[model samples]
Target: MLKTILSISGKPGLFRLVSHGKNMLIVESLTDKKRVPAYAKDKVISLGDIAIYTNETEVPLHEVLTSVKNKENGAKITVPSNTNELRTYFAEVLPDFDRERVYPSDIKKLLTWYNILIGADITDFTPEEEPATEETTAETETNAEEKTE
Candidate 1:
């Protein structure tokens, strides 16, 4: 899922979260499989935390990516360089995408990211489910006991 994928500022490509140490995170490049340490000073963002502006509300990156995948049929797309063409292409993918808020560069970035993800063979754009905590487990047991009683 996108949770473990990272985009470090000033970095060229996406990275996978490998591990973390004090004041730094060890990230592996999705493109080259190179491991590098990202310091606290670096602005690192998880793709899962990204959202695109829409007419009504913001849409999560995963949903946008899924839309792109559906549009492209799970294949890499040729990113349109022309601004108007790019906008038109993006409109086809996300019809309700905010016209005023979403810039052409943003659309281009989204398309480029989609291509990168596809190249990496990461077709699944669904968010990863959070594991159940101990509290939730106990609550489930208590509910089961009550049902039995």
Candidate 2:
């Protein structure tokens, strides 16, 4: 039996898999429904959001089951229904997003959080800044003196 797990997605008419099997198990569904069968429970190869069927890995179906069961609600492995248009939509919009405005979070390196997300890999980011300017400082001293009076 072909113990396989398919991370299924679609790009318009072409259906693709996030292949994870030790053997090649790529196939196209002739039916109209959109569900990866339990039969293909382990033969999946996960590469980003893509699935491939090649001689690479050996994942048990139970692991996929466990992962799915344990997965956070929004984090489940799935493709949207408008997946056919996703690539086109992404291609058009991705470059427009403000990469220039993004600054890495101050706590990202200090807090041991998940690094799997593709955030900016900048070593130049600094957390601390010098104290406020002199005019602002003098206003604060004057306010303190007034408060004490």
Name the best candidate (by lDDT).
1
Considering every candidate listed, which one attains the maximal TM-score? Answer: 1
- The lDDT values for all models are 0.93, 0.31
Worst 10 residues of 2 by lDDT: 109-118
| TM-score for each of the candidates | 0.92, 0.18
Off by over 4 Å in 1: 141-149
TM-score for candidate 1: 0.92
